[model samples]
Target: MDDPMQTVYVWLDDEGHRTVLLFALAAALGLASVIYFVLTGEGSPTRLQLVLILAAGAVLFYVSLRSTAF
Candidate 1:
């Protein structure tokens, strides 16, 4: 059986993998923000702020992936 960690390392070592990883992270953050917003009805100000921050992070990561100034 192939080692999963080794496979992951190999995949990340390939060109464009950084962009893929950033995209995945951004997607995860976006999903988390949406889920939090849906699950927490009448969320506190702090919670809302956290969700906004997560969404912002997701957008920034996605933009960075598309940027040439990596």
Candidate 2:
């Protein structure tokens, strides 16, 4: 059995590299979206656009959780 009180660090070790990459990809996508919207003068992002951004974030979150899971 594992030590119940031992803290699991998610973003502070070798496994964190994958999580960092996922977060980087999400950030890049978000930045590109903002740039495109600003240059095109789109008053608001469409539903699909928002969904895509959220999807990227969700994927990152999922990966982080999976990595930390025992």
Candidate 3:
């Protein structure tokens, strides 16, 4: 008789878990930045900086979401 088939289990390692955590953090940061930007008045260097940060966070979050590591 043939031997029973073996089973394999796949799980996320530390780096994969870290990547997921980073993605979550980036998403939260992006969302908070958008809310803050909307609440605050416009037309200032600080506002501009916040916008830049929001954009960066969005892009990073997207990349992390699409990454295979997580």
Candidate 4:
């Protein structure tokens, strides 16, 4: 029998795990960015930027969902 670990690439997550990770990571990053902006007095992301971020998150989510499940 083949080594299952050898065949594995995605670190053993369920089908929807990637979607969860993508959204979660994006949310974490977005929150961090917001906090950083507030602390550093930097420009915050615009509404359009948030929309694009959500779009990117959705694309990542769907792509992750459609990918192989370990």
Candidate 5:
């Protein structure tokens, strides 16, 4: 039987690296946005909104880290 975890999936061949990088960049941007909001209090984002943003950032970061093949 083939091990799913061992399966390698490439995204556009060379673009796989870029995809991972993009995800990481997105995560960083999301975190930065949250920090800015918290520090400056310029924008009025509700607690739920902040939590959602943080969750999204975490998910994107995890995806980037786990995207070894793609």
Candidate 6:
């Protein structure tokens, strides 16, 4: 039987590194969002711009989730 509260997969070396990188990227993106909001001061981003940002960030998020590549 396994401990339901603990994730065994995360203990693997590869998964651990990928998880760390994803968390780092997520933290950086969060900071950037904060800065953007602070600087822009509430002007709404255009639909095109929003779509582009989301697409690019999704790619980055996918990359960060990989175990084989950084």
- lDDT string for model 5 (1-70, tens) is 7665454433334566666666777677677767767887765886655775776677777775767655
Please write out the lDDT profile of model 2 over residues 7-26, one tens digit for every residue: 34433455667667778888
Model 4: per-residue Cα lDDT over 1-70, one tens digit each: 8678865645436546656766677776566656655676646666645665676677667766677764
Candidate 3 lDDT tens digits, 22-54: 667766766676666677866553655577577
Model 5's alpha-carbon lDDT is: 0.67
Each prediction's whole-model lDDT (CA) = 0.70, 0.71, 0.63, 0.63, 0.67, 0.62
Worst 10 residues of 1 by lDDT: 40-49
Candidate 5 has which clashing residue pairs, if any? none
Residue pairs in collision within model 2: none
Ten-residue stretch with the least lDDT total in model 3: 2-11
Ranking according to TM-score, highest score first = 2, 1, 3, 4, 6, 5
TM-score of each: 0.55, 0.57, 0.45, 0.44, 0.41, 0.41
* TM-score of candidate 3 relative to the true fold: 0.45
User: Judged by TM-score relative to the true structure, which candidate is superior, 2 or 6?
Assistant: 2
Best by lDDT: 2
Runs in model 1 lying further than 4 Å from the true structure: 1-5, 43-45, 48-52, 55-70
lDDT of 6: 0.62
Better by TM-score, candidate 3 or 1: 1
Indicate the residue-level lDDT of 26 in model 5.
68
Clashing pairs in 6: none
Q: Enumerate residue pairs that collide in model 3.
A: none
> Weakest 10 consecutive residues, lDDT, candidate 5?
4-13
